[model samples]
Target chain A: MREKTTEPLVRIRGVHKSFGSLEVLKGIDLDVDQGEVCVLLGRSGSGKSTLLRCINHLEGLNDGEIHVGGERIGYERRRDHLLPMTSRQAARQRQNIGMVFQRFNLFAHRTVLENVMEAPIYVAKRPRKEVKREALELLERVGLADKPAAYPAMLSGGQQQRVAIARALAMHPALMLFDEPTSALDPELVGEVLTVIQDLARSGMTMIVVTHEISFAREVADTAVFMDGGLVVEKGPPSEILSDPSDPRTRTFLSRVLKETA
Target chain B: MASATADPIGESSLPIRKRPKLVQWALIAVLGLVVAAGAFSVVNNENFGWPIVFEYFTSPRILSGLVRTLHLTALSMAIGIVLGVILALMHMSRNRFVQSIAWAYIWFFRGTPVFVQLLFWGSISALYPKLILGLPFGGPAWLEMSANDLITPYIAAVLGLGLNEAAYMAEIVRAGIKSVDRGQSEAATALGMPDGLTTRRVVLPQAMRVIIPPTGNQLIGMLKTSSLVAVLAYPELLYSAQLIYAVNYQTIPLLITASLWYLLITSVLSVGQYYLERHFGRSEARSSLEAR
Candidate 1:
């Protein structure tokens, strides 16, 4: 059952996104309460990742609105018009939203510690001493305390993704967005990254994860959302949705993915 | 041949292979002969006047001219690189009028030959004999000065060389910026970094890897191109050589001295360029993969 009470932390109301003439998201409406781990699942090119990007303003909305932490995202409603914020103003809103990319987009030139400490020190304008202490603590939490000084290029793909997670957490954002975080990792390496994410979920960190790792989704996701063709086909608790999905498209996708792994 | 003969040490049943590198030996022998013949011709030719080249290479006139040449190159390159960076940013501006203005400046400077441009600058007084520091056309003048007094050969050379080099450097800088991946800028922006900070800290530092080598080449080219100012009679290295050879009728030796100096400076620049490339490219600190 979907939890729809007590002020949803993320509320998407009739959000529509299109690129040129092609509609990527058509009226996506959903809600996640505080501390809810919502796993977005779908086949390739089904607009799951696009929806996640829209939440962060990496993609613009064609119509409707999204609210995160009770504030309008990407656009400001002034006198019945959805006026877009300036790039600088839009960046300020992203400070509350941490995004982990599929490729782990860690700054290749900076050491692991610097990568985590960058946004906190430079963007947030925090004092270096306090930020350094917390950043080191984050690295230790991510099991990379020894690699604080190692550059991104020196670490494995899994380790880099872990550092990216640490970097995002250093901001202490209210909500985190994971765009197929482990999809780019090697099969064996994916476990390491997924383990760290599971720990985050257990600690009640609010997250919207877009992933194809069905088992990980089942284990950690409080709610499972299956989207297809720019719309959410079905959404329910992971236990109910994974075993007995009502939508035909969702069933077909799950069967194919599960068969591949088996 | 070495790989073909090599086999696993424990697998003793493999055949002992034999290979001869006759083709490589023959090529090396021919290359050695060509080197010997070329060196013999250059050393034996008395028209080169090796003794005269050695004697005047360090002459006070030549040395002063070399100093002037280096000074002109440094000033012109600094002006070019600074203006070039600004023009590149302007070219990438979202405003069409700004982009067009930058484009027009590049077109005008690059369309004309540097030699012709230097000549034009040298003869600027003929076009406008008097320059007035004033308001718009026909307005009251704040100050008036004769163009010939203001635009000496030295000033003309600096303007000509610096302005012309700026056009090429602008294109080089733009290309370097374009070479960076779009994801880099997106990540920086998503991290809430302001545009100016992102460009300076993230974009430019990464773009430096691409920008440095071509910029080094331009520096060396500017050192050689400073010679074009000779037509303005500015007394740079080539002009000084011409002045020396004109009086003594020793054109070839003096020219050789100038060429050798240019080569030596360029060699030093290449070494510095190599180190800069290594510093940026090999920045990743080594930490071996840890045990699981």
Candidate 2:
């Protein structure tokens, strides 16, 4: 096992989350260094996705702290009292972080270019001309320059997910979170979206992805965290975790994934 | 061709069994007979004179009244649509006070007869003789206008008709808005847009697909309902016909003239509605095809 480092870009400590008494994440603690691609491998409902959501404050945490780029998210210290920040304040913090949803929640009313430009113009308050220029550049980066004027409903599932990534990247976020970006796509369409993400990973973007595509995880991620039952069951380098998992649950999950892939 | 003929019958191969030819022919014949009966009665009736009908329809008073009816319908529809959108947004607002106020507005207007509301508005002087505009505290000088002086019959009719129709329009707008998926709002929020801007730019455009058909229906309904304002002697189409009949005792002829104009306008509106629906539908169809 590699020695755990003290300096990390994202630090989650003793974080707990519950949705109306149904606890989804229980006491999760993990760290990802700067520019590291960490793939969270888990079955459905294993809290891997919820943990990624917590870092951006997309999902509220019941207890503990999350820090992204060394700034605390969803929490405030007021005269020795720790308070959960209001939703608007948390949203401002979320600006430094960007998320792509499992369902590729693109704004259906907007064209591909406008979808990428919306956050920069509305949230970041960038000038319209600059935002449009940057948005087109991001679209070209995702190999979707031809779809600039296409509404989401006019794009394939894979194309829409790629546009979603461009939309997130347009903000120039410090960390990008992807929650099963290809899970909702057709099997044939999955590779196109994964290739876009793989390209992003190769370009040294800090990413935390909750994904089921084990081969992509193994090939692209620097570290892999295996989660089960709302807890991080094991954490190590991708070769160690995917090839030689220590925990029985991790081994069983790998066996199932391998069998399905084969 | 041999294989196609030998294939077992599927859902579409039930012999295209339509109504028997005799039955269809009978239906058309019955419809024609009904129309002919109507025409014969009109032609034979003592009050139904073609020359009198033409004269009454071309009369200056009746023509002016027809113009007034059309003008009122257009003005009321415009005001109703604007008010309806605002009311819809207020009804959907998260603030409890605004929602309740909107609810009360729709409730009162929809529950009461529009005629009663018009009468009440026309006689607003009986309740509040003056219209005062000022803040609760002493912020500015009060601007007072007397109800009797300012509340003209035409203004009362417009207010009554527009406000009453707005209640129905609000429901249509709410339904249109609700038809959009909840995720659209979440996606807009994720993009960090404020709620109002999200609604204006993202939500309302999509909601228009659901809103426009029902609004077109409401406009047609309002065209017919505007005739009720004649009870206040606003000199609308129906009242103009009544005034002519009261003088010349040609009741049926004048009513036929008014009916002809109303039918023409409503038919035009119906055709407009059909084309608008088709336009929206075609775009939606194209988008779904692209999605697939």
- Give the fraction of reference interface contacts each candidate recovers: 0.43, 0.32
Docking class of 1: acceptable
Q: What is the DockQ of candidate 1?
A: 0.42
- Candidate 2 regions exceeding 4 Å error are A1-7, A74-77, A80-92, A121-129, B1-26, B44-46, B135-141, B288-292
Candidate 2, TM-score vs. the true structure?
Answer: 0.86
Interface RMSD of 2: 2.3
Mind giving the per-residue lDDT tens digits that candidate 1 earns over A1-262?
A: 5546679899998988899999989899999889999999999888999999999898889998889999999888889688998888889998888889999888777789988988998899999999999999999988999999888877889999999999889888899999999988989899989999999999989999999999999999999999999999999998989999988999999999999888
- lDDT of all predictions, in order shown? 0.90, 0.87
lDDT of 2 at B258: 89
Best by TM-score: 1
